[model samples]
Target: MRLAPGRAILTLDLALKLALVVLLLLAVVFPDWEQFEGKAIGTRILTYPLSGLLVPAGWWLFFRGRPYPFAADVVVILPFVIDTAGNAANLYNSIWWWDDANHFVNWGLLTAAFLLVVRPLRLSWWNLLTLGIGFGAATAIAWEVLEYFAFIRNSPELETAYTDTLGDLVLGLCGSTAASGLMAVGYQHRELPARS
Candidate 1:
């Protein structure tokens, strides 16, 4: 059976959040779990529940009155689930490039979600693309800075990794571009109706 759009997102969002709770339980109960090692207390708290929660909270507080959140919102939250799962399953360092993949994909989803939420603007296609790219770049930079201050500064290895920062920014750029293209195609095809 087909579910309503909003119901589907709510279900998926709830399931993912519950999964994170389970992952957090594992992390706390079995500190020796390979995935739990080397994770700072602040980092775990931020990544596991706090940061991961803001998307749904933002949706409920700001966007729930709409017919439903754009599917892109659900897409936006998918990365949190993926990232949390990777960490909980010990895949971050185990599988090389996992972090990089997350950065690329998450930024793309976020960019898309932002555009969808603000689609009422009726901006020119060019302007929308510019907005998405700018938003993605700014977010990536902000995240990198947060990482630096929150956890990276304490670790000598992360402090020296300028290339990773640059790489992440590049990925964000690419992701934003991709999201813009996706939105553009949707608008062009009339899949996304302009508000008002």
Candidate 2:
């Protein structure tokens, strides 16, 4: 099947554009910026818009030539946006389970996106499931390690707790597995012969 952009991609692009405009306006007009307070310029940029852009950026970098479904794009972009926005609003700090929930949902989304990317390969169900879950789990662990080195290591507020890291990894694994199962079922349904 030939790949093409659809309403979903257009809508995602529009939302991203709107986010960019909002970020710019805040940068220009918001004095005593709550989100950026006491944050380094580099960290501020990475935390807000840059962090939010990673999903679409990954799409451009890795999957631009492929034909991805609109739902796949939505699956990837929405949770990451929510996670970034939640972080900006300090929801992670306020709600104890918010971080865990984001980890589960966002990693699930990532796994689904990866499965969609590889759909054209026509891998076996088990292989597809393994790839999706493994990739998502590895990526989740890598992200936690990156966080430890970048923001968590030296911070007085954040600690590199073994339990927390393990919990995040477990949540990521669960999410990835769930997404992989859904992909398998969807593929099975699509493959079934249609009734006349």
Candidate 3:
């Protein structure tokens, strides 16, 4: 029997994660000494995941007729959207990549992810705060690792690698913090206890 779109998405998402593990091997390219600057790291990190997600996401968007689980919707959508756009900007680094704009863009996205996750997780105020910070930091580190070693690994002139990685972490934190704050405030008025 044919799988439903939702099921197909789940399968595809998992497959993408696995595929990422494989493509990570390509990270050890011959180094370029220059141009490995900060925020540029964010650009690199965003590339594969965005591309990995886009095809399946696009397919699902067309095939699925029913509404998604709320948390699932946010989890799936925002990352794909922001990452795709951000990485696209990276393609034209000589043209489209803007640092300040990228920071705010990522911050906005991470915040959205954090808030969305909180509602679904039904995190308490304290947990929400912890998760936001924790998630932000974790993703930032992972993204940096990917940037420094993976796609841009061959660059010898990585002046901004560390700086950009730092910026991405900061922006991610801002996003996560914003999300947790929204969740905490929203929970105060909400009667539903989203306990798992």
lDDT per residue, candidate 3, 1-196, as tens digits? 9888778767765754654534332332412322333335344445646644543464466534534443344454445444434433353255444554555455555655545533544667667666666776676677667657764556653765677677767776776667666666667657566789
lDDT per residue for candidate 2 within 65-179, as digits (tens), equals 8664556655655665665466457677679899899888888888997788678778878788889888988998997887677656666636546778899999999999999
- lDDT for model 1 comes to 0.74
- In terms of lDDT, the best-performing candidate is 1
Q: lDDT of each model, Cα atoms only? A: 0.74, 0.70, 0.54
User: What's the candidate order when arranged by decreasing TM-score?
Assistant: 1, 2, 3
Measured with C-alpha atoms, the lDDT of residue 127 in candidate 2 is: 86
TM-score of each: 0.81, 0.75, 0.54
Instruction: Score residue 116 of candidate 2 by CA lDDT.
Output: 80
Tens-digit lDDT string for candidate 1 (1-196)? 9989677778887776777767667667777776766556446655657645565577677767655554654666666667667888788879888878888888888898888766766776777778888888898899888777776666765755688788988987888788887877667667457689
lDDT over C-alpha atoms for residue 10 of model 2 = 68
Off by over 4 Å in 1: 1-6, 51-65, 191-196
User: Cα RMSD (Å) per model?
Assistant: 3.8, 4.8, 9.3
Better of 1 and 2 by lDDT: 1
Off by over 4 Å in 3: 1-68, 89-100, 107-111, 118-121, 191-196
